[model samples]
Target: MTLLSEFQQTQLPASYANLDPATLTQHIQAAKAQLGSKLLLLAHHYQKDEIVAQADFVGDSLQLAQLAAKNHQADYIVFCGVHFMAETADMLTAADQQVILPDLNAGCSMADMANMYQVTAAWQAIQARYPDEVMPVTYVNSSAAVKAFVGEHGGVIVTSGNAEKVLQWAFTQKQRLFFLPDQHLGRNTAYQLGVPLEQMVLWDPTQGQFKGQADQATRIILWEGWCAVHQQFNVAQIKALRVQDPAIKIIVHPECAYEVVQAADVVGSTHKIMTTVQQSPQATHWAVGTDHNLVQRMQATLPQKIDFINPIACACMTMNRIKLPHLAWCLDQLVAGQVPNQIKVDPETTEKSLSALQRMLMLS
Candidate 1:
């Protein structure tokens, strides 16, 4: 396992360029069958249908990471998700197990928005101003370095599904909480827990400060970052859907804006969204605001008339990087005893990151 910083090149070979879809699928399936129990293919829900079809397990980022950690038989954990997710799997899984991302370039935009330097500076400024214990809570959609920082500072990692539970626990330990990466999720979860909007503030990493007067009264400081996919859905889309058919129920991910979430009939994690749509047999019409791939998947497989709130909403470009050709090429390399795009976190980073993750696990 090579660290990301030491990773040099992992571009897909030109041999796969002309391969037809059927050929690619055959190659992927063959490699899987050959690898057998030695391989565990994990795909995030945001992945395209073809990728999901080849996955041994299809779930959200955290769910996939947890699955990777539990599968001890698999020597290779091929994660068909973004870079951050792969990094997480590597951190959680046994040191002997290698985690691979099909495409080296598949990275989360939200994770890139906040880095170690910016987070360190923000913590310093907040401590200097507030004179209170400020707890750090990072979303799973963040870099391992950020998670390490949180862990070193005695904080816990959180996901959309367990954010409320973790945040409540954080508040019990500290006077203030600094949420990393995704502002919408932090704000939405805190609001649901009865934290007033006035008590929550926004932190601007670019400016090296908070957006407003984030004083001692500020209980929650949200980092200025969001998911490019979920941010596309707005209140107007909900209104249009309502006007088109009042019977249409709007289910959305918590990553959407607060206004959009408020207008939504149901708000949850990606797993929750899938379960809600599948279990609600009485609801026929539905509008989902999240990644386009997952919504499109539901539309095709589910009995309900499901639609993406914003049809024009761009698919997760990073997740789309893991195409059928890329998967085929990756698996073929593995068959040849060559590892490509393997994600490996350094020892210090992995240890610290696991501290935060384990804290979350304990709470859960």
Candidate 2:
């Protein structure tokens, strides 16, 4: 369904617009009770606490998609994450099952950075230069079209947890790798693999050229795109946290800048960050660099012995857009037998994108 018209028709009824926390909770719980196993809620870790508390499964994009793929009994999958995530669930699940996004505007800035047009142009330029020596490796935080592009080019998709493995596999197939949508992730993964800074070049899609020397020796071509949220966690923030409490350990997502990642005591995905904090020693303090919601959630759920703080309080505004009202409204629609903001990828794109996703799952 069209995002604009669908949202217009299914916008939270005026009475539910300013619902109190208790009332909203009741409505959501009632709907869940009514739908039972027919409805499955998938929430990303970055989602607000209220939304996450109601989720049947909470994880990163790939993990959520995997959960949807495995659940054959749920007729409706309500994804309380960004648009691309719902699109991914739609791509991975059976045709009879429907995936709905709580908010159509909940789109990732990093994903938007590398559209099909820009990617196609960049691919053409790179192919002209390196022929078949280059392989495209897109981060999972990208659009379905971008993933399909990678699949069509015999490339694979990678997540933060499996980035190193995927990159290693890519290098085995080609002399050069074009990492997309997030420059920091590409650079960090390549650096860990012994790829020198000099050999890695940054490709500015807007400028349509490489920032550094584009010699034949260039091994990793990084796209000049990054998560607005993770980019806020800089080296200064880490240093400030260290100054305040020298004992506090700093952990961050790999999407942060090279300097930020380098400064972090630990680097991992959102799930990894959560697991680390959960398993840490008692009385240990942590300065996390990721979405604010996740850090806040960890502080609420983890043991009191483990203290958590944000290196920088940065929230992914897009992710935050999926609030309680949006979720309540979406659930009401589902209970009423109406599917609003349903995400459906075209058949061809789903097939090709699934190929890239399956490759990552198999290799990871």
Candidate 3:
């Protein structure tokens, strides 16, 4: 199968760089007003506050994609997230509705860890060993090509919030599970479902095989990939946070290391963490382990009640690439009758990948 060429984002004009944050905000608002209902801005929870302020809808990646699909009235869907997220929105939205990423360079590191070549090679080797015993289960934070590959093999996609249910469904379908990208999420979720550590094996894509011997007892094959931001939160931070505030409830994302998830009082997705923090009593002190921006947002809304486990910012660098200037420029281009940084998956890939995504939606 042929791969799509990389989309390179050109450097913004000097005028955009010269504009202040207030000016950029003005530009974005003006553009949105001009486009009216034709433009739909979707922002992820991890986005900067400025981007979220201008968005028509703000939620997690899957929620935003589903919203894009549901709102067919929009002519343009501006996705303020990573590349994989924009691709997802493009695949889910109507063909007439264009999906645009503010910055083409913004991409998920975890998703990039599993490309077509590496995934196909791993699939071939695993099939040879397990035969009909394995089922492919990819996280939503992956490339469309990878999702299409999973669809072609009768597999389903999983999200952080609904991982356990999806994994449970996968186990019912096959004897063994091949989880893609984030190994930490796979390990953490499988452990919750009563699968012991020894029963799970790690697949080193660099080595093109399992890191160790896989016996019949092996129920999961986790791809050795992780979120750079989530991995930054370690046991030390959890320990320090506990020492600072013994009563503070430690909540973390499953993307964090197994040790961190185990150490925390609660483990959940981004949406879960936000709602937990927001809905909790004002007296409840909370320590969140996820993207720095989301934590910062919570801190602003609920002062003194929230703090990041890692005192040093653990921001998603790729997500941060879509700054106020990029958004302002993207909207400016759209208002000028041009589509900048548009994300479009081919019809063949879209059809195949949508099947896998649909399976996830159905199960969720």
Candidate 4:
């Protein structure tokens, strides 16, 4: 199945919400009682309804990292997100704190786009073209290896929250910047900042060269990677939705295609989408483009207000791997003094990767 329609079940989802509110409350109270200072549940906005509802802290990548890092009192951080996100949490937190994922198979396709070998070769090729005048900047939706490549080379990482500013800061530091993992975001942000489309070019991974009509290299260089989920919200889909429901406020993630972002009323991260609706005064309708779990959860909460914009539902298959069962089982193992799904990064990789994260932090 394609990334948009894919839903492969590696494990079954168990009933984590079967108990009465009072009983569920009691269990959490008891868990806290038994495992004092040993637990901190951090969930992503893209996580399922059952998992997100019970999380101690919930946010996007940067927010989750900040939460995991500052919460030094907790010994175990059960991250309800993708593998890279858990890796990020682990890198940010103290050495004593353990970051565990519910499912080891849950990975981000965007993160898989660029690895150490690929990135090194790509950077080297780009360097051959532009020499040390260019900087390597990657989106946060990438693997630690990619970040390490950037960090070790005096490059920086940019998140959706601060991509534009980071790009501005990057250019000020270096003559040129090569953005990776999401071409759409890099292009859109660049265009927004008066970086002419003529100046920006696409870096073709297969050929290892600039392959766009625009010949100028001073603008942003976008990698070929994209979020399949966000890409599903194409111009045709947006047009169809608008014709069907003109009142529906279109909201999208910045990772989406430029046309989709331009069509939407608001473009932001997943947390911003939730907060937008939460802060809306009237009963506003929304056509959201993101992970299915998050949009589904929003619809469940405000049934009359929010719905999936896509006629063919867009689902991030990797994000769906960590269902309630995997979550419960992972927590159960931790509760039983066994680390079932611990993800630890090597010190060398960690040292390099942390610098990229630090660059993003310093940019913000």
Model 3, position 293, has a per-residue lDDT of 90
Worst 10 residues of 2 by lDDT: 1-10
- Name the lDDT of candidate 2: 0.85
C-alpha positional error of residue 75 in candidate 3 after TM-score superposition, expressed in Å? 0.6
Candidate 1 local lDDT, residue 292: 88
The TM-scores, one per candidate, come to: 0.97, 0.95, 0.97, 0.88
C-alpha positional error of residue 94 in candidate 2 after TM-score superposition, expressed in Å: 0.5
- Checking candidate 3 for backbone clashes, the offending pairs are none
Candidate 4 is scored at a TM of: 0.88
Give lDDT per model, in order: 0.89, 0.85, 0.89, 0.77
What is candidate 4's lDDT per residue for 1-364, written digit by digit as tens?
1121222333433455454555544555465467766899888888777678778888888788778767889889888888878888888888988887877778888878776666777778777777777888888787767777788888888888788888888878887778997999898888777787778888777666667653435666788889888878877877788788887788888999988888889988777788888788556878888888888877777644776778576588888776655666566567789776777776787899888888887777
> Candidate 3, 268: how far from true, in Å?
0.3
Candidate 3 positional error at 237, Å: 1.8
- Pick the winner on lDDT between candidates 1 and 2: 1
Rank candidates, TM-score, best first. 1, 3, 2, 4
Q: What is the lDDT of residue 280 in candidate 2?
A: 86
Over 1-364, each residue of candidate 1 has an lDDT whose tens digit, in order, gives 2235667657677889789999999999999999999999999999999999999999986688678777888999999998888999999889899989888888899988988889999999888977667889999999889999999989999988888888999899998889989999999999998999999999999998789777667889999999999889999989999999988999999999999999999999999999998998746799999998888888889999988799998998988988999999999999999998888899999998898998877776
- CA shift at 329, candidate 1, in angstroms? 1.1
